[model samples]
Target: MINNKKYLVSFMLLVASVFTSNGQDDMDKFVSNLLQKMTLEEKLGQINLSSGNTGAVLGGGGEGQLIAIKKGEIGATGGSSFESIKKIQDAAMESRLKIPVLIGLDVIHGYKTIFPIPLALSCSWDTDLIERSAQIAAKEASASGVCWTYSPMVDIARDPRWGRVSEGSGEDPWWGSQVAKAMVRGYQGGDLSKNNTIMACVKHFALYGASEAGRDYNTVDMSHLSMFNGYMEPYKAAFDEGAGSAMSSFNLVDGIPATGNKWLMTDVLRDRWGFDGFVVTDYTSINEMAYHGLGDLKTVSALALKAGIDMDMQGLGFIGTLKESLDDGLVSMEQIDQACRRVLEAKFKLGLFEDPYRYLDENRLKNEVLTDENLEAARELAARSMVLLKNENNILPLNKKGKIAVVGPLAEATGDLLGAWVMYRNRDIVPSIVEGIKSVGGDDVEVLSAIGANLTNEPNLRKSLSSPFAMFMGEKMVVDERSLEVLIDEAIAVSADADVIVAVLGESTAMSGEASSRADISIPESQRNLLKVLLKTGKPVVLVLLNGRPLTIEWESENVPAILEAWAPGTAGGNAIADVLFGGYNPSGKLTMTFPRSVGQIPIYYNHQNTGRPFDENNKFTSKYLDISNEPVYPFGYGLSYTSFEYSDVEINKSKLNGNDKLIAKVTLTNTGDRAGEEVVQLYISDPVASISRPVKELKNYKKIMLQPGEKKEIVFEITPDDLKFYNSELIYDWEPGEFSIQIGTNSQDVKTASFVWEK
Candidate 1:
């Protein structure tokens, strides 16, 4: 058996060597040869990323695109289907050099069999699950001829008001970095030459989540220390995981647009971080730079090329004006060659040079897309992504034999279950909440449903909230024409005979994605009124929220018997929710972002620097809110389980340590309840004194473990001086030797602490 295993490994190595002979040296020589034969027009075309005529939001180019492909005037195209992409590849085969075009797509969460949004997935704290989901998405996408995906958005979002928060991993930079690395590994795998893998594009290159006023595409400004410590870790982590591509954000960095910022793209990303991948602009960002107070198309295109941008997506600036800029001495050929070479290098790595049609297999598309196995995996992930915010008196893991009443605007919602950035999903196949309850409840269980209210009271607001891409995707927000009074009356009548009411209420799919930021992050008036009336009926209510971001649910937190944060669980969402509700599965998810008590606390987060005068109840001059407490409604790393768990005091192996010593911390965790449950044991570090101010505590490590009732286990973590290091005021990364606090807990707010000292 050992000899056979060794032979298998040798065979695999031989296959890889055969495919990539001399590796990087071979890739360099091949691209260099191609660059010599290409004219100036062809070189510019190598950096031109056109859009397909697939009715996508950023789609363009119909017959003209085919002509350009034949003339070797296009390097890549996004948003194209299998048939269209095959047609585009055929056109490329007719070009002078017969260079095939790279196919790209959004494929954010999933391609066909969708999973929960990235924010919700992060709550699971299961890197293995997240990685498997990405692998499935890559399989489905590669089968459909997509070799590149602009995904794994690693922006660390602190403000829940930022609509794009749904697309990121959440507020903590350390945890978000873990998610970023997992996603990159999942998408790219160990071998890019395989047809099943797709190149991962870690995006919005710089700090895009810190937009002013939590508005999308707004200007971002902050100190260098804050930038390095708070927002930049995840992006760097993704790149370090061997991500092959990146997308420039649609915001300004250092007073210049990211598409043309030399310091950002060239100095920081390329020189400092040593990112060797190609960089692409986000949806005509170069053209939009003109609106950002930069020069016209010609000037911005030249600037972007010199700033290390390799590809222009949906922007004709490069192919249309680079030659003019070259002739006018505005840009040099060397810079253009560098960009073109990187693009070609990516193609060679994808094995496109060996076989352009490697990923366009019809059989794989027929058997792999939306398979039963993939859907089952999606269902399990969606269940794990659900965070049980509150479960007073153990109201969840509901019995399947009771009469279940499902009510709300989203009770029977089909399309909304898939959430945002799902371009290739089959909404008709998605089972609604009512359907799921009925199917999972069985013959003895009785199920009832009603539309309690409209998504919003105003027709104009509903229409305005619809996604712009809905027109092309055959999607529209369905608003009932009946009056709110009539809807509530019907809802009340339906729930009167039920044993329990499950209110599936929250924002529609259009309410929380790009450009959908809201000033009031609370339940809508229409839905809130319905919920109040239902509560008056004296029936037990379980609030199942479907929002993308953390909402201000202070009222519901106080009134609702139980609450579940089910953030737009994807295609199998309903089935997954039912699985958790009926005790088929145990929910073990935790909140990745902090839930503020009110919208006024826009920037509330767990790891925040202390103010000169910290908040105090007795000190009138201290930093405090007069109307409310300074604490959040639900703190970060917070969540509930069906069974309870207790933590013992933290134990340290030593109270003092030297420069190279390792401090060992241990905690005894016991399941104190009557059922089995999973718990996320989090570890945090705090420095009492530093060269500059530091956050109160920063998450350093974590472990998710499952414990049966009455089980007791010791959790241990080894800390080195490296874990205590941070970027200082002078931008130097190091640690200050001093007294430090080590904390271990179920969540950030509730923890047992121990102190240790380290000397340099």
Candidate 2:
């Protein structure tokens, strides 16, 4: 068996080399020769993009695609399939030079076995956990025959309204950069040429985060210093860790769309940051330039080519019209050659050149695809990402010796638990919250549960706009599989007599991601009405909200005793949730994004710049909103625990330094409550003044510490120059000579502050 395995490896290597060898010793040699043999049209063909017969949000995958690929007219394909992958391989074989087609997918969270959204992962503040999550995602994705994933959306999102913020690492670049590296390492692993490792594409290449008004594909403007100092770190970090590709964002960075901004794509991403990967335009980003008034497709394609976009993702113009532009002298052959070479290099790194059919092997494919192990991993991640929002009077760690009423839309939802971007997880495999509760509760706890309502109250949201919800879920637009009013009344009655009401509420899978953006982020009115009935029962209630984005739950927070913000935990989510509820794991998650008081306070953030009209909660006007307070309902880095902790004795090893010194900042934290719990000791920096207006405070460091009852320890963070600088108004990043505040605390809003002066 060992000898056979060795022989298989040898055979694979030999097969890989012939295609990977660039037909010569050096990759550049192979690329130059290949480019030389290519026609102007074929070179132009290298820049075209096409959709697969299936998997597009707008359309589904086909043989026509195979025909296009075989003619060497197609370069890249998005929304491909296992069958499509095989067909593309056959087509590539028919091409004169036999170059493999690079298949890409929006394997955002997971291709098959999904994990929590990136925002949820950030809440963990655990890099190892985040990496492991990505590793699991990669394993399942590669198993499904996907070569590349447009993931690890590293754009630092401060405004939750951006909708795509659900796809990012939140507002802290320090933490964001850490997650960026973790995700890149997890996706690519130590090997990119290996089967389990899919190429990780770091996305929205430039400043897609600072979008105007938190709108998708919105205009973005920021100083170079601000970009370099904060927003660009994650992209740069991914590049440093060897990301396989980059997706240029649709937003205009400064004044130019990142897809056509030569300075951003070439000067910064490649020349300055030294990233060697190819750049692809975001979905239809190239074609949208006409909307931006960038002339015709011919002019824009030339601009994009010059800007460094190699492959066009779903941009029909690049693939359909680049040839005309080439002949029109709009874009040069050498530029086409460079773009094609980059794409070819990416294919080489993926080890597709060696044996393109390696991933297509049916025997191995059957063995590795969505194994029980991967599902188990997803279940574990789901559990860990669940953050206990509130636990008043120790309402959680539910007693196994009581009548437990598990009530709401998500309690018995097997499909909803997997959440969004979970295109491949088998729903039946996931045990619902009730199943999880019953599994662990055993004969000890009497469990009664009811689906109080659908995820929303609006007939338009659940059913159809014009139709009544009577025939919904069976005929018209489905309103979940349960009866809403019947379920709610039953749940209220059940909870009226129960010892505890574990009211599971919040969004179903269709609620908060991508185009699922909400103007009003709150628990559904149907569920909220159900909550009112349950709360009236006067039994201690535990609210388990299954949502994607941070929601407004001030009423629940102030009224309900316990709230668990389980942001659509994946398969086994119910089980993990049960475990946390029964004290299996003390919830340690902190919010990466703030929960505002209302949608009116949409842009609220902890790291926000102090405006000229700053409001002190004491005042009514200025920066404060009259109807609602300026403060976030729940601040970023805020999460409650069953046990309590105390922070004290902050000490700095050195107050001042002339050089790049490792200044140690320490704080003593004690588990003051009886039960042992974990704490995220957040460290933030405040630049009193800068060449540009800067955020009042920025996250610089953090440590998640676990302590037994009465245990105390000091966590020390080494301060560095990198943490002190920001991109100035002039686009230069350097720390100004001024007093800086180093604050350490349990949450972003409440912190212990100290002053230190930086002198040159």
| Worst-scoring 10-residue span by lDDT in model 1 | 1-10
What local lDDT score does residue 274 receive in model 1, on the 0 to 100 scale?
A: 98
| Residue pairs with backbone atoms closer than 3 Å in model 2 (clashes) | 16-354, 48-319, 53-60, 53-61, 54-60, 54-61, 225-727, 225-731
Candidate 2 segments whose C-alpha is farther than 4 A from its true place:
1-25, 52-61, 79-81, 222-226, 361-364, 463-477, 480-485, 617-621
Cα lDDT of model 2 by residue, 1-760, tens digit: 0012433454454344334454325566556666777776676666666743222332123667666666776777753456657767666667666666776777777666667777877887888988988887777667656778888799987676666777887877778889999999998999787878889989888778777777667788876666777688888888898898999988887678789999999988888889888988888899888888887876887789888889877666666667778778887777888898888778777877665655554554677656787767766676667788888888888988878999987788876766655555467677889999989887989899877776676755664322432221111223555566577678877786689999888876656555555666778688898888888888999998887788888898899998988886776687878988898888888998888878788667788778897887776566766677678778988987878898885788767765576667888999998988889999999987766777889898888999999999988888877778776666666677667889999999878877776665
| Candidate 2 lDDT score at position 639 | 87
Clashing pairs in 1: none
TM-score of each: 0.96, 0.92
Candidate 1, after superposition: displacement of residue 389 in Å?
0.7
Q: For residues 1-760, write the lDDT of model 1, one tens digit per residue.
A: 0022433343344334334563888788778877887999999888999753223333233667788878888899874577787777777777877787888988889999999989999999999999999999999999878899999999999899998899999999999999999999989999997989999999998899989899988889888899999999999999999999999999898889989999989899999999999999998999999999899999999999999899999888999899999999999999999999999989989987666777887889899989999999999999999999998888898887878889999989887888788877688889998888888888878988899998887656577666465433324667788887799999999999988899999988888878778888899989999999888989888999998999999999999989998898999999999988887878899999999999888799999999999987888999989998899999999999999899999999999999899999999999999889999999999997999999999999998989999999999999999999999998888999999999999899999999999999
